[model samples]
Target: MTPYAIATQYAVTLLPETDINSHFYEITVDYRGHGLWAITRHRECMNHDGDWDWEPIPSERTDEWIAAHRFDLDTALRLAKEAAPHVTVNGITAVEALARSARREAQS
Candidate 1:
């Protein structure tokens, strides 16, 4: 399988005014064709506080948004890594695990 097949795809959405502060921005990650693997929402902030404070958004909402919106995978990944450095490590680990799993499945 191509690397992209197992790699996580992410997208961000900025909401308009009137919503809860915690749900100002939506972030999503998709794994293969298994639909959304993760989703989170962040409060709008001008600067990073260096704290893990994102709230987990519902999977149904994430799936609906992802289906409706289109995202540039490269840019999204870059931005995600920039916004949360820890995501880089998570992304790499996820990719490696997926690749290994695929290889094992193929061997079987």
Candidate 2:
């Protein structure tokens, strides 16, 4: 993300992937007020390094991860829309929000 791109004020809370840590699936909206580039990781605990360092989740593991946690991203998105009807996304689907942000960022 560009330095100009700031994080939106709100965060989308998702189901915890394990009883590991207090904050899991810490998804945040892009500066444009849409969740793109959301962080999806199991923050069960700090690593041996004593920090919560990690890598991005691979696409292949998405289904398995969700299954293990019984968490569905689509359902989370739907709930967000339902709870916050005032939030606007230019008619873009929440799933596509991040991709759209990435495209816009790439063009700059």
Candidate 3:
């Protein structure tokens, strides 16, 4: 049997309108089963440990379950770019090519 995995790609940045107290923004694309994918938004905050925390920004479209839906990688890429233009892998605007951006941030 082949391996079962849910691959996730993330693009995160500080919100421009962010208050000095709160800085947050995240865009992630997850590969769900079949031809489905999930584009999720997340915000940063403090956790119980007084540490950085991330929570999903829920929307009606993404909140509930559905039998069937259609989405494409291009849409996901656009959303991520809109969320953070600087969220690029080697200056590339396409989010699909930016899965390694997080690693770059981590390294730098």
Candidate 4:
């Protein structure tokens, strides 16, 4: 499926150190089939040792992550459409791809 991208305002740090740390991050919640979603948070931000500190964390279709992060199917679709409604593949938007994937799982 075409992964939907969500750009969060900015990373919240306890210390609020530098301007670079305040930059926005494009967090992608990828649908890994079987009603599973994994969130890829802060891909650009690296640790002092040069490792991806924020990796893709797994979540269920009906998890609290969906509520807190507002990543449910409908919400994701709305956000994606608002961001780039014109982007399509075979006339299907990112959210439509996600919906199709969900429907496929349900029908099976």
Candidate 5:
């Protein structure tokens, strides 16, 4: 099977308005399938129009982002699903993709 990474977007709206912190973000989970996985989180930006959008911020891969070999693919996918309501992968939402996979599994 081809190695794939699941990218899911998330937002923090429940935080108090007075809280000065990131509100929009994306977390990309790269599962190596050996109980190893890496999580890279990117913060979304708000443009002048006040619309939330993604802007790739280039930076070095420091200790902040690294692989953790402690979970299986199922756990990784579950995490992807937990990022629901805002998770989009390859034009298809994570919930949709996961539901489709479930249907296929059920058929098999």
Candidate 6:
């Protein structure tokens, strides 16, 4: 499996104004049917006075959002590395190990 990541930008809207802050991103790679999924959702602390408190954004519509943003897996991984390189890692080894184990099981 290829490396994957998710990035999010926060836009705060007051009753009469708007503010944008640092973009938050995360990367995760699948391995042996398990992997780490780290997210830094809404890391911006630029909440202005009288602005609504930060609220969790729904990800159920992520497919639509990804389409709207015109982001592909490569772009996503690149963005993730840019935002947080330490979070991304290789998973090919784990996948290979899993596959070998599966093949052995099948033969058994």
Every candidate's lDDT: 0.38, 0.35, 0.42, 0.38, 0.41, 0.30
- Please provide TM-scores, in order, for all candidate models, with all chains considered together: 0.25, 0.21, 0.35, 0.23, 0.29, 0.23
- State model 3's lDDT: 0.42
Which has the better TM-score: candidate 1, or candidate 3?
Answer: 3
For model 6, the superposed segments whose C-alpha errors exceed 4 Å read: 1-26, 29-64, 85-108
Q: List the residue pairs that clash in candidate 1.
A: none
| Candidate 1 per-residue C-alpha lDDT over 1-108 given as tens digits, one digit per residue, 9 for 90 to 100 | 655535564554332223232122344544423342333324321112223343324453464444433234554344444444233233443334445556766798
lDDT of 5 by residue, 6-90 (tens): 6333232222233332132244445434455433334432322323344343354333222222234455445543543355556
The sequence of per-residue lDDT tens digits that candidate 3 reaches over residues 11-108 is 44433333221123345555545655445444332222323334444343343232222235565555544556443334554343334445554687
Weakest lDDT window of 10 consecutive positions for candidate 1: 41-50
lDDT of 4 by residue, 1-108 (tens): 799986433222221233232123133444544443333344422222322333334443244433333344444444433443223455655456555556766798
Lowest summed lDDT window (length 10), candidate 4: 13-22
Angstrom error of the Cα, residue 65, model 5: value is 17
Q: Which residue pairs come into collision in candidate 4?
A: none
Q: After superposing candidate 2, which stretches have Cα over 4 Å from the reference?
A: 1-10, 13-90
lDDT of 1 at 14: 35
Highest TM-score scorer: 3
Model 6 is weakest, by summed lDDT over 10 consecutive residues, at 13-22
Maximum-lDDT candidate: 3
Instruction: Estimate, for each residue in 4-78, the C-alpha lDDT of model 6 and write its tens digit.
Output: 874333221111121111121222311111222222224211111212223224454354432333333344344
Clashes per candidate (backbone, < 3 Å): 0, 1, 0, 0, 0, 0
Give the residue spans of candidate 1 off by over 4 A.
1-52, 56-77, 81-92
**Candidate number that wins on lDDT, 2 or 3:** 3
How many clashes would you count in candidate 5? 0
lDDT of 4: 0.38
